[model samples]
Target: MGTREEIAFDRALGALIGGALGDAMGMPTQLLSPAEIKADYGFVDCFIDPAPEHPVSKGLKAGAVTDDTEQTLLMASVLLQSGDSFDHHAWVNALVAWEKDIKARGGYDLLGPSTKRAIDAINAGTPPEEAGRSGETNGAAMRIAPVGILVPPGEALIARVAESCRATHNTTLAISSAAAVASVISHGIDGADWREAIGFAVAAARAGEKQGHWVPGGTIAARIEWALDMVEGCSIEEGIARVFDRLGTAVISQESVPAAFAVLKLAKGDAWEAAVIAANLGGDTDTIGAIAGSMAGACAGYDRLPQDRIGGLVGIDLDDVRELARALVRARLTDEKARHG
Candidate 1:
């Protein structure tokens, strides 16, 4: 590969691996309150298995990733196969298959509420597009990295994001949140600076809000803007406290999406710190950490992540994920060339 292409390839790999690292690291603390997290594991600096008392993650080993990485891989595989002609049926099928696989393994970490409800609807004869018309969770946004990587940012791209979300999360806020995350990944892949990437995300989200069917709630765009603004001049601890207390870190897209962005901004593009900070946050830590790690990984590239942390990932091979990232970058380049040439 040429130098520029090689760099892109590395960053893509970094983004995926970094996401996994964050997911695994935060698994033990996923549903804990911030005070509970502090009381139990302290700062959560390393990967630890689910504590016996842990409500959700018990029986899972340290370094094992949860639904976040699994769903992200589902989307990545679909993107690799279909490229710009991505098949919605294929995407939904992959998710359904993944949900089954996770359950068969006796893992309590199954699909999120929106995804579960939508998939049930699809299984019960509802059309895929109508399955999740009211889903407002971060389910779609959490797994949207692949979509952002493969598609250029624009109205069409955001529409495609919303369409993909339709399989599970189709509300205006959900779609906008997913579009924002995807746009950040897209812009970051194309080498936009951290601030520039945030700008792209905010703009794409504003436009995306108008594309999806409306649902009653606060605007994701405004929430994202407010979250970013909240962290501007604060200390890292103070910024995190603000996000934890105010911006929120729950499964709701309105909260998690903006919180993820705010944490990433606070980390200033450092993949490790971003993941660590998100991991320590109360509520939905794994997803928030994964999101931050994904964005930071895209900005900093794979080579920048520490070797020890990469070595600690459970049930995942770094080389395999690196190969997946390479394939994804190649597919994206091919898709871009065909459109712009």
Candidate 2:
């Protein structure tokens, strides 16, 4: 019987590994329309040779992760080095350093336009908050799960994560989207049920709404409510199909975030099912899989992941990620004990 600490560590490791696996597996087909993906690959279930023209294809075939996992691990390294505290300068410096490394490696040289602009602003001596423009890209939200794990749960942590998002994604929609996903991961670590996690995610979205970071009128909750109504009584396959058909697969936060949530709900608490469904959704498949995988990993714990898939992942620090996850858990527990003691 594993101890509670061992179980929690496993879950966190599962999430990290599962997230990277999903991302790498789906990278080759990312952003391809469903029809296009079908015509080219016929239900892609594993990482394949990238089309010659695909930017990530070369790296995908080599089992190298894209910016998604790279940025995530970068954040994790920063948090572990910082003893789980938020330091704006240190965070910004980390981002800069990672950006430089990615560029040097020619890996993320062709960065998302918004990310490039934000990084350029930072390089030009702009403050983190002022560095970002009003871009609603998923760049920020896609790599934000580490922040959720590092911070304690509450409005304060939520707000801090949202603000940290301003370093690259300052748009209201982008920030709100990041907060929604981050909140779900945080709630999952706290051992909240799926319903409660969804509720907390909605609350975090509302918190962003309150800060004028969401669309005016109804919030992410309203959108999720509408999405749920659309998929009510539908099969997971049907729901995923409908979302992919209607939303299309793009890297925009608004396009992929809700779709990820829809898949999460449809999975009915099965991490593998949720991740596989999200990964094959066509556009921005990697991002969708990453988001849903994070939630599912938190919900199911790492031990539930298939050892086969975990074994298939390459070009990353699996051991370091596991250690980092355990460290983050320790940091959280230490903080909680201090607060309650």
On TM-score, the candidate that comes out on top is 1
The sequence of per-residue lDDT tens digits that candidate 2 reaches over residues 214-326 is: 43333555565555566667886688788877754577776777777787788776666766676567888877877777777776677777777667666687778887898
Candidate 1's displacement at residue 83, Å, is 4.0
lDDT (0-100) at residue 161 of candidate 2? 70
lDDT (10s digit) by residue, model 1, range 1-341: 44767877877887788788778878999988889988888888788777798887999888888899988887888878765565767888888788778789887747888888888898899988888887889888888887776676777778778777877787899999988888888777887766778888888888779765789989999999999999998888798789989888889999998999998888888878887888788899899888888887877778888888888787776677877788878877877788889
Q: What lDDT does the true structure give each of the candidates?
A: 0.83, 0.70
**CA-only RMSD, every prediction:** 1.6, 2.5
Can you give the lDDT of residue 138 in candidate 2? 75
Query: Candidate 1 — which residues are off by over 4 angstroms?
Result: none
TM-score of 1: 0.95
Worst 10 residues of 2 by lDDT: 210-219
Q: Evaluate residue 63 in candidate 2 and report its C-alpha lDDT on the 0 to 100 scale.
A: 41
> TM-score of predicted model 2?
0.90
